[model samples]
Target: MKNKTVAFIMAGRRQRRRRWILVTSFLALLACALCCAMLLLGSTIYPIQDVVRALSGENIKGVSFALNTIRLPRMLAGLFAGFAFGLAGNTFQTMLRNPLANPNVIGITSGSSAAAVFCIIILHTSNAVVSIASVVAGLATVTIIYLLSRAKPFSVGRLILIGIGMQAMLNAVISYLLLVGAEQDIPTAFRWLSGSLNGSQMHELPALVISVLIGTPIIVMLGKHLSVLELGEQSAASLGVNTDLTRMVLILSSVCMIAIATATTGPIAFVAFLSGPIAKRLVGVGFSNAIPAGLVGVNLVMAADLVGQFAFEVRFPVGIITGILGAPYLIFLLIRMNRKGNL
Candidate 1:
């Protein structure tokens, strides 16, 4: 009997490890494919070799304009933002053990959108100023949510409800700002409001990349702690997890990534909220799937952007496409979760 038990345990452990390895490899390959697809997509097609050459420091004129000046930065922004959203969303959902704890739900994206809209419309700040304003607003929004949510016993539901209210109010302010602004600024503000990467320039890409580079490792390194937290706060505390500090650090890192991404690309919608769970489901993993989540986030943005580009005469922002895709799924989740008393 003892020998049988030991063998069963060993088999389970080996299976878990095998699943992790398989998921990780799949994510890595998917990321590579996304990069390649993004490089090759657009009004004008460029060869994969030319794309590589341009990236490798050889300038091929028209190819340089096509790859470097245009597609590369946009692709990088989508990649990093999607990854951050996925990682951050998974962090919150795992820590809180709730599917709806994504940044989009928590109002971070709306907060950034509110500020970006204000800058573009009322402040007449375009180009760089809009990004700075968006980041500032996002950080502010995070602080507000933390305070509103830090009462007793930490309720994720209260946090989400308050966040939704705040989102509505901030959106109202954006509308007011637009209402009072000059007619000429309206189109630019509209673009920002729609959460498109259409106006993204190469200059804005570096700051975003740097922010992601710093945050990604932090989230990855905390994977074990996050997994432990999923066992419940009591168990995590018993396991020496310093639950509060770890959670705070993860949230801050996630916020920074999302804020920077929002500033760069506007609120690209549902990438953060949906990618983590979808990836987890695909990998048939438990809650320790933030890495796969991030990869799915990347794949989602690239795929959605491709769809937006080709499906219509007018290019749609990936955010709009994501909203269309994610809304029904979210409703389905809510309905099922409510029926199961999980909400």
Candidate 2:
């Protein structure tokens, strides 16, 4: 009997590890393929060799100019921003054990968006200043939400509800900012509001890239703690998880990633809201889905951008495509959660 139990446990562990490997590899390959397509499939498509050569710092006429000055930055922006949104969104979902507790749901992106729109319209700020303000505003908003929602028992429902209210208020603020802005600034503000990579440049991506590079590993490393966190606060505390510190670290790291991503891409709709559940459903239970979620995010953003660019007579921003995809799911989730009394 003891031998049988040991064998069963071992098999379960092996199976879980196998699933993780398969899911991670599949996501990685999918991301690479999408990235290659982004680089090679634009108008006046360039070959792989030219793309490689341009990446290697060589000048190859139109190919070099196009790849370096255009495709590369756009691709990188989607890749990094998607990863940030995915990672951060999944972290929130996992930590809170609620599918609706993502950054988009909880007003973090809206907070960033409101600040950026304000900077663009009212303050007449540069993009750099707008980005900084967006990040600061995102952090501030989350902090306020946390304080307002923190109770003796720490209710996830309260946090989510507060976030939703904050999101609505911030969105109203954004509309007012737009309403009062100069006519000349409206176009730029509107484009940013829609969440675009239209004018993405290499120079504007450093903060996002750096945040992802620094924060992703930390979150991935804390995946075990996050899983423990999902087990309820008292249980996690009993298991020596340092609940408070872990939550703080996860929140701060996730916020930084989402804020920078929002600043760069204008809150890209529902990438954050959709990535976690998809990754989990693919990867299954018993394994961390942080990296897989990020990769899924990258794939979603890149693919959605492609659809927006070529699917319609009118080219929509990436956010519109993602928004269309996400809205139905959000509605379904709300309905299901209501039925289950998880709301």
Candidate 3:
């Protein structure tokens, strides 16, 4: 009986692992397709041959300029930024064991947004300065949230509440800045606030790309520990996980990735908030869903961008489309959580 049970458990594990691999693979392929669509389906559609030739440094007139100058950077911005948001959001949700604990809900992105807006309006700084300020502010915001939540007995609920409060405060500051700013600067600030890919350029992608590349490995390497951490502090410690160090590392890596992505693309809405749950639902429960989550984010951003670009008579920002999609899901989630008494 014991041997039979062990064999059954092993078989189940194998099946789950296979399922995870298949699901993650499918998501990766979908993301790739969306990226291709981003590059190919713009105002003036370019054939795959033209895109390929243009990518390979061939100057094919209009195709070269459009593919290299515009579409490539736009696709890359959505790709890396989406990955960063998805991965970081999943890390937060998993570590905190709450759907509401993602950076979007917790004020991290708001912190970045407020700093970026301040730089745009009041300081009139360059994009580099704005990016730096936003990244610093995001780190500082998370640190503040963590410190405030670390009372006599730490509580995830307390942390989330504090984060929400911080988001509200930061948002109010943003509103005040906008209200008092010169009218000329308001449009610029609003464009950034709306989270666009309109002016994406190759020059602005390095920091974000680097952050995602480095942070993703760190997060994925710590995936097992993250899963264990989800079991609570005492349980994780008992299981030989250094919960504090692990949690701190995870938070830092995730914040850096998401912050840099925000600096790059201006908080492309709900990619962070929705990626984890979608990946989790798709990939099921056997293996770490970090990669799948990132892929899902890429698909969401790219697909939404495509939709925003062509779906309506007017061109909409990618963030607007994501907001429209995410808001409904957020409402449904809240209602469900409330019903389950988990809200």
Candidate 4:
């Protein structure tokens, strides 16, 4: 009787999990369709038929160059970068089991901003140079935060606190640079800081896409290790899970995604922080949907970019839209965390 009940419970859990995945997968598809709609339904309003033609090879007069060159790259960049950030962010939060353990909450994005700010203002560099600087800075920030938080063991809470401090310091430097920069240079610095996927070049797209392709699978493949790690380090070790090696590999792979995304587009915003929680609610809590989180990130970036581009006269970066949306979610998370005594 006891064995039968246990088997019944397991079967039920599996069925429920499958349902959860199906629901989230459907939502992801919806978001992707909406992205295409936004791409086509811009100020010009190119019909989907023409858009598809231009996308394939059937050049459609004036729409071809505009859609293919301008909007397509921008749309794709936002999509991929958002996906990368979301996947990475969720991995960290889930691995650490802390709501605040996201790429944005840490100084990672700030590092990119700081480097890009310096390049724009003092270096007077071109776009390529700025992107390079952002990647370097992102790596440095990640390294610092990782080192500071890791002693004999890992502590997610301490890591977040330190990351917040580091972010504040980086922000102060960026602000100071902007303040003293020549009038013309300030705008460049300002734009990089704000995070935009606008004006994405066709050249960068291949490289960015390739990086995502490479790193995404590594994240997905590591699911087994993640599951083990969730069982606690000692338990994982006893169970033949190499905790240190897995953590290192996961961190490296995630950083690659982040650096590539940040380089291609500016570090957008809260997709990383928000996607994991949203996807988790849809999927089972025990399963890690790093890919799903990435898709959510992609949806977030593309959607925000579209809204920012046409929703207002100013044509803001996708980052601003995300900031507006994410801030409220973050506050709610904070309140909830407090209520749960995790704060």
Please report how far candidate 1 places residue 275 from its true position, in Å: 0.7
Q: What tens-digit string does per-residue lDDT give for candidate 2 at 1-343? A: 9999999999999998899999999999999999999889877888898889888998898988788788889999999999999999999999999999999989999999999988998899998999999999999999999999988788888999999999999999999998989999999988998888777899999999999999998998998999999999899999999887899899999999999999998989999999999999999898899999999999999999999988889999999999999999999998998999876
Where does candidate 3 clash, by residue pair? none
Name the runs in model 4 displaced over 4 angstroms.
Answer: none
Global lDDT scores for all candidate models: 0.83, 0.93, 0.93, 0.82
Model 3 Cα lDDT, one tens digit per residue, 223-310: 9999998899889989999887999999999999999999988988888989999999988897999999999898899889999999
Estimate the lDDT of model 2. Answer: 0.93
lDDT of 1 by residue, 255-279 (tens): 8989988888778788888987887
Error of 2 at 201 (Å): 0.9
Better of 1 and 4 by lDDT: 1
lDDT of 3: 0.93
TM-score computed on alpha carbons, candidate 3: 0.98
Report lDDT (Cα) of residue 167, candidate 3: 99
Count backbone clashes in candidate 4. 0
